[model samples]
Target: MFMRAGLTIGEFSQITHLSVKMLRRYHEVGLLEPDRVDESTGYRYYSTAQVPNAQVIHRFRELDMPVREIKAILATPEPEARSALISEHLRRLERQLDTTRAAVTSLRRLLGPASPPLQVELRTSAAQSTAAVQAMVDQEEILRWYDGAMTELDAALADACLSQSGPPGGLYDNALFTHERGSATVYVPVTATAPAIGRVRPFVVPAAELAVTVHHGPHDDIDVTYGALGTYVAEHALAVAGPVRETYLVGPPDTADESAWRTEIGWPVFRTGIRVSG
Candidate 1:
């Protein structure tokens, strides 16, 4: 009987602390190919020298790195290049973890008792001249759409040498929240008549009487604040005609800490109702 040149698949699995199934998957994906294969018996064998590589693959897998990305990392020969690949994946994992943490915190608060009293104010906003961009966007893509739109508006404002009158604001159409697809308009108030360029054009944001509340921290739990405000509006019969208005007081480009973020949510209402005073 001829002995194998290296460790058999079972021995290799023991040495690498990988399951037989996992090892086979690694082989199948060309991630950690076996050192040799016996053609007659169709047996797979891995060399002892492959232990380190197997361990690295295991660690990356534990980190939830995608197999394709792991393959890219392993294929790169340069130390710096490999480090960059790993760093990129680590950053992505961090972002995912952050989102998870935020969700957990948000869920706990939502599941618990009713939130503290929120001061809803009624204020009449005067009609304003503005440079704005409007587009139909999905709910999931609203954040990305907002970022790009704001960037464009900023560039247009710069090109036109116009100074912003106030913090940037957005008008979210009802269809957006109702059907999850609708028109979204992002704008910056400008002092004078601004030239219409590209998607950024001059328009008038109609005035409205709004019942408003400030949402603190990240938007992960903003729906809670929205719910509270909505309840207050419905209970008082203050809800009237208009899409929701958001005034981004302290947002990105201003602060990276979500805890420090402040957004003002406004529900349109009739100015005549004298129920709750601000």
Candidate 2:
């Protein structure tokens, strides 16, 4: 016997514009529940009083809130706490939107009708001692890994009172491009020996002559530039052996706008056309 429960599952679905399957899933996840369940016939019913709650849940779901987070937001008795939780999710959505917009802009440039010519340079870098962090990382996690490693190196350099000699750079093994998983090292050139502690360690980045090219803007379509540069190297018979190097000319700790970022991609090469055996 149900009191004040006139709405059957179908009727409730119609009123809330929520699918029965979704409502059932919400009930299974303990996110929402029916007002009554008939034990004999296995029928479910919702009361009119629960309609507002269901509507709110649907709105939260439309905003892409996870079930557990939605449950927490619903369970918070204080209005301010509930609002804060929703606000946090909104901020995350805003950040995601920004990334999406940047990617869209990058895609347009990459897929545009006119292709731009790449400017490649051959420059030799001298060997330098630096504070660095190295790890075998997945391609998908490289961004997060780089951020963490860079922060650690910066703190270590500051603690040791080491002055930066040049821009921050990274070495990415060929496997990263070919197999999508490989070792990566991020280093900040320091004036003197750095205290090797935790993931931060002393490393000498070997000198090499590189076929260099500047990749302008965000890294979303950086592979295009890499391809062009690699083609240039191949056409000119400048191929050599070593991991690829990336120098962050204008990047984070300098600006947040990806449009303002500038990265220099370098592929190792030899001075003469004679291919030196690796």
RMSD per model, one decimal? 4.0, 4.9
Can you give the lDDT of residue 149 in candidate 1?
87
Q: Model 2: per-residue lDDT, tens digit, 1-278?
A: 75564688899999998999998898898888888888897788888888999999999889898999999998999999999999999977876776687578667877898776777777888998999999999976787799899999988988888999999999999998789999999999888887888899999999999988889887777877887888878877888878999999998678988779999999998777544221
TM-score of model 1 (CA atoms): 0.77
lDDT of 1 by residue, 39-119 (tens): 998789889789999999999999999899999998999999999999989977876776787678788888999877888
Please report the candidate that would top lDDT against the real structure. Answer: 1
- Using TM-score as the measure, the top candidate is 2
Candidates in order have lDDT scores of 0.88, 0.87
Error of 1 at 170 (Å): 1.3
TM-scores, all models, native as reference: 0.77, 0.77
